[model samples]
Target chain A: MSMYVDMILGGVFHAAVVFLVAAGLQLVFGVQKIVNLACGSFYALGAYFGITAVAGAAAMGLPSVVVLPVLLAAGLAIGLIGLPVERLLRTVYRRDESHQLLLTFGLLLVFQDVMRFLWGPTPLTLDNAYLAYGTAEFAGVRVPTYNLLVIAASIAIAAGLGLFLQRTRTGRIIRATAENREMSEGLGVNSNRVFAAVFTVGCMLGTVGGALVVPASAASLEMSVELVVEAFAVVVIGGLGSMRGAMAGALIVGLIRAVAIMVLPEAEILSIYVVVIAVLILRPAGLFGKAMA
Target chain B: MNLNRRSVLRGIGAAGLSASMPGVFAPAIAQSKPVRIGILAPRSGAMGTVGECGIRAVQWAADRMNKDGGIAGRPVELVFEEETSPKDTIERFRRLVLQEKVDCVQGLISTGVSMGVAPVAEEEQALLIMWDGTTQDGVKEAMPDARYVFRSTDNECEAVMSSLLSVKYFGNKIKRVAGINPDYSYGRNNWEAFRQILTRAGVQYEVVAEQWPKVGTMDLTSHIAALKAAKPDFIFSSMLFADLPVFMKQGSAAGLFEGVNLALPAAGWQLNQLKKSFMPENIVFGHNTLYFALPDASPLQKAFVEDYMERYQQAPHWEADRAYFALAAYKAGTEAAAKATGRWPKLDEIIDAIPRQEVQSLGGPGRFRADKIAEQVFYQGLSTNDNAYDFPTLRTVNAYTADQLQKPPGMDFWEWLKTAKLPV
Candidate 1:
């Protein structure tokens, strides 16, 4: 019974990481109608920066409490990188969607190679700060404080973004653009600026996701494709552009994977694909997505 | 726009004269052509960097060979072909054989890639040298006609049995065993082998839990959690590359290693790579054949290590040692073949002469088996600090001979697999 509770808690933690990445992917795809394959690259970059910052801080005799903020700052810096890329992407807005897809794919390869050149072909690990000082008991199961922190941060980020989108003028403008870009442009919304802003936010969220998971894992040159493909599956199954849908999708995938590991270990490899195929067959537009007329 | 009849006639005469002189054209053609060795491996996909190391090792070997007066007194050249996807491996292999006209082909990091290229090599009658790919079915599948295919690395079954032997050495101190491996052939085979060996050894193993994350998985927290929940006394992790470090970091942070003994067969080579990232004391490390780097105190091993470090500016991994030994085997086989036939023999003739061919390797002596896989002796070692060496090195604890380590021929793999019953 305790083992079962631990597995569920573990599943929730895994879901949180997936939600952070999928939320950003869903947002970018929802508003811009562009599948930003480079989100994976940005995620990897964020983790790299996070690990470097933590190592650099420790080298400089900084307290461990400063690590999380340093990681967040690194994530924001990666978000700033999206500003220039978003501007470049704007130039090709009038081109076919395939052009954007190809550009992002090219960026993915370029970023991965650039990282390889900078960091060499070795994996780097960040020391455990969260586990050193934090622990919590839930449902008679002992869980890492870091896992709880990730879950809380994910919820806070999701709720914070949800509220901002629901009540803020800029958020409404982004949503309006997502609904119909032509209509938003018709209303003098400066759709290009809106696209850039949405892209920046999306990239920031992805970076934060990477930053959040860095302490638990090392940053490597190979993380780009694995993260991006999984993120794509999450957003597609959650509803292409819905934050709520992304969270739901991430949880579903995460839970399915965790359950599969316990109940059917042999089938764990195909668990995600099985879920994605079932969801697609049942609802082509996803769980929360509206079908295009 | 101005043309002269005399000039046109002179041009035609010159062309005719050059065409008629075959001796004049000989130097030009000979200078342009060089003996080419083709390299094929994944360079941009899941197994990219691992493949990159194999490619680098081959290039380094070819360079060293060329520096030593080349093969047969002619310059050796290398032509690399990158296979980005499994779907394109067969076609790319065909192109290397039919168009590139390579003398030898090497480099495969995954079993899938090896299986894909075996038929192509067989069809073209090209000599295929496999560096680091393992599929148990490969030897039987390529039998009778696929004599040109040869492997230099240990198979999955050998690796699994090696890990189990290490577990046995640890003995009753280990209470339970868990596995964290990728859900592919390599991972599955390792798990199956470990389970079979453990059951046969009369060791109690409750799989408590197993995690089979997708290949190339970046995050392994959930898998780590599953492992922790099992609360096994030891773990046999088959995760490679990025996932390996990720799991190690997470496991370290979660205090999962506090009371656990961890044995990772694939991570022995990676210990040096991650030395700067993680503390060596925080985790227990064990692997198969600590390679030439083991604390052997042999003159030959010392010379090889010192020379490799001096030349490459970094310590040599198992891949480098294996590459050097493979070349050495080739040299020994070729000499034996030459001695027997009194002439330079073809690849088959050379291979046939390699059954009992002996060569002094960085890791002692090695020979070829009936399956075409090299029978290199391996030793299990524990990580230990040596005052003699600046860096940490593996201290040999157990040496398993080739006969003891590997399964005998003609034994059914399934019959071996039937021993994996759980201790209920």
Candidate 2:
């Protein structure tokens, strides 16, 4: 029973990390009708920034708690950088969706090579936080405390975003714009502003995801492609642009991955792809996604 | 546009006269056509860092040779080809041989990549000096002719045998052993080697538990728990790089290492770096090369260590050092062969020259084995406190000779299995 609890907790933590990045992808695809493949690049950059900040703080003999604020700050910084790109993307809003994807794919390559130029080609570990705070026992199972913190932070962000989207006028206006871009423009809505805002928010989510996972995993050059693929898989499985779907999809993917690691270690590598394919076959639009027709 | 034909002919005659000058093209080619050596390894993937380091060492050796008047006055030119995956290795090898026409090829980090390019090297009749990645069957089965392919890295059999020797160091203290390795050919081969060596050593070992974690497993909590529950005297791990440190960190946090002795065969390079961060204790590990920082009272070792430290800003790992030595041996072999034949020797002549030739390595003198592998020695050391150095260093306890560790050629599998025994 405890083993099952540990696995569930592990699954939840892993889901939360994926959710932080995939939520933004959901929002961008929901509003813009374009697939931003570069969300993974932002996640990787955010993680790299957080690692450098945490490493710098540690070198100056700062406490491990500094990593949290560093992560948030790095996420926001990446979010701000995404603002200009989001503006540029507005020009291609009327273009074909594939054009946006190709542009973002090019950005992904650029960011990946830029990361390699900065961090070299080896994996860097952030075991310092894990080593210092140590493991926390939950239900007789040892879990890294940083992982729990990641879950808590992810929940807070999700709730905050949900409240903002539901309760705020600007948030509703952005949603109104996403519902029908031409209608929102007809009703005197600044569609360009909405697009830029949503894109920035999406990038922020990805950056936060990257920053959060750094304490658990290292920031590698490969993370851009790996994280983006997983994020896209989560977003697609959750329903493109559906927050509830993204959450459910992340949990399913994370649980499946963890369970696969336990039950089928050899097949663990293909577990994610298998899950995505199965989910797609069962529900073409995803669990919580609305049908296009 | 309106120039006359006579003026155009005069211009062409002038260009031809310049082309016919004494030292224009022919003498320039004759004076400085160096032996081109091609290096193929991944430079932009997961294993790029180590691959880049190996290439750097190869280039360093090539530069050093050219500075010392080259091999028989023909300079050695080093060409590096980056391969992103195993699929690219064969294509790149062919390009190097047929197009670039390199005299020799060297440096591969992946066993799959080495095996992929081995047949091409044989078919092309070019010498391939493999600096890393050794599989007992892959090396022998793929390159049975053994005329062109030579491995400098210790084979998996020798690595496992070295780890088994450490079991005897613990003696009856280590009663049982568990194995944790990546679930691949390398992992399975290492586990088999360790089991065979243990059985031949006459030491009783229970199959308490084994965990063949998927390659690149980031989380090791469950595997650590499984190993802890078994409570073997020691654990033999074939995990390398990121997986190695992840397992060690989780194992330490879970208190798995508190009661158990850990024996890792491939824990040489990165674990040493992780020691400063993790402070690993009470573990007896085996590496192909140990005490790499110590000069062993040899000028060659001292010079190489000092130069490496100055260049890389860190101590040279066994991988880096072995590659340096392999390149040095290649130079030495070429020099000897060229002197005897008065021309660039063929693959067979180079292989023959390697065994008869010796070169000063960072570890000591390295020659060729009858099995066509590097006749290198192995050492087992304990990680002890170093009051003088910045980091903890390995103190040598045992040194195994190449002859004792190597299996003789022409021995069948059954005969080799019967003769295989752990040296204590």
Candidate 3:
């Protein structure tokens, strides 16, 4: 029973981060009609930048207890790079899907090299900040207290994002624009501003996820590329452009991975893709994804 | 004097034919043509940092060799290509040999890429020296009678040495063992070899948990939780590159290594990044063949370390040592062949001379086996922060010679482990 609890909590921790990146992917695809494969790059940037921010804060004599807040702030700030990136992404928004993929894929490669230049080739991590809050024991299993906080934070972000999208006037306008961009433009909505804002928000979701994960994982040049694979798996399984699907997909993928690691051990990654393939075969649209036209 | 098309074509054909025939003008060709060594290493991915380390060392090796009058009196030229996936690397390997006309190819860190390029190297008849291919089974299976391929010490060596080191120190305490290795041949082979040694040594233990994440996996939280729940007394992992630092950070945070005896056999490549704060003091870290802080460093080791630090702005690790070993082997082999035959050695002559060639490596004195595998010392040590160095250095360092660490020439590694008496 304790083993199961530990496994579930572990899965939840992973799902929290995966949900953020998948939410960003879903949002960009929902409103901007552009599959931002570079969302993973934003996450990696967040992680790398988070390390710098924490180190800089520590150097300024800030208490180690402030590591979480500092990482969140760094993630949000670094995510603003999505604004300029969205501008570059704007050229392909009206173009074919191939063009968007090529541009974003190229951006992913470019971001990898850029991070390499900034952080060097070695993976970077905070020295002692991960355990600043200490470990919490439950059912004889110890988990980092930081993990619980990140999970709570992710849930809060998810609820806040859902509320903002469903309840706000700007949310309706953004939805209207997503439904019919030219019509939204005729109705006096600046689709450009909406796109820029939505894309930046989406990027922040990914960046925040990346920042949150760095406490537990080192940020590397390959992190961007590797996360892209898992994020895509989540997006595909949750149905494209669906926020609720992202949540559901993230949990399923994460939990399944956790279970697989415990059971088969060899099928850690293979098990994730197996479900992905099953979803593709059985439900062409993901678990919560809307059926395509 | 006649400027007809046929005459000009015949003149060009004759010139090209003569240029292609090195035997006709051997001395002039040897003197004029630079000895080009093709270097293939990952420069932009997970292994990029360590790959860059190897590249810098090989570059430094070339410069040092040229300073010492070059290899066989010919200046060294290195052509580099990225060692990515096996397919892309194989394509690059072909281009490096066929297009660049390199005398030899060196520097492959991945076992997959090395295995892929092994047959290609033999087909192309290019003298290839692998800097960090550590899979013995793959090598034995793939290149059975390989004449043109040489490799670094096998992964089994480090695994056996690490097992010996672990059991010798903590055999009485360890009862339950777990593993979290990368889901690949290197990881699988390391764990298997380590397990085989433990079982062979009559250490009564049960495997509590096993996790095999892919090579570039960033998250090991679930794996850590599972390992914690299983409550193993010892955990063996073969993770390296970015994965090692990530595992150390997450595992330390979750208190996974609090009471567990961690054995990281292939982690010596990550000594620089595995700082003192996060890395536990009691864990056993294997540096393959290169111990950066050997109590008594040789002149070559001291020179290599100081020169690498000056040139690369960091301490040299096993990757750099691998590069140094490969270059030293090439130099020794070519120079010996040149002296023996009274001229520049041909490709086959150089290949023949490379086997059984002795070279003083950064680790210590080393000799290549008749099968082109370099036999060197393996070091395993406990991390100590109170050392003289800025980073965490090793204490209670144990060095195992090749005889004790490696399998016999014709015997299987597992079979040899069953009867081969280990130091432990």
DockQ of each: 0.30, 0.29, 0.45
DockQ of 3: 0.45
Model 1, residue B147: distance off in Å is 2.2
Ranking by DockQ: 3, 1, 2
Better of 1 and 2 by DockQ: 1
Least accurate 10 contiguous residues by lDDT in model 3 chain B: B4-13
By descending lDDT, how would the candidates be arranged? 3, 2, 1
Error of 1 at A195 (Å): 1.5
Error of 1 at A143 (Å): 4.4
Model 2 TM-score on a 0 to 1 scale? 0.87
* Model 2 Cα lDDT, one tens digit per residue, A75-135: 7776776898787787778898789889989888887877777876667667655555677
Better of 1 and 2 by TM-score: 2
Q: Kindly report which residue stretches of model 3 are placed more than 4 angstroms away from their true locations once superposed.
A: A58-61, A138-140, A281-283, B1-33, B134-139, B310-313, B389-391
Which pairs clash in model 3?
none
The candidate 2 chain A region of ten consecutive residues with least summed lDDT is: A260-269
Listed per model in order, the count of residue pairs whose N, CA or C atoms clash below 3 Å is 0, 0, 0
User: For model 2, what is the C-alpha lDDT against the true structure?
Assistant: 0.69
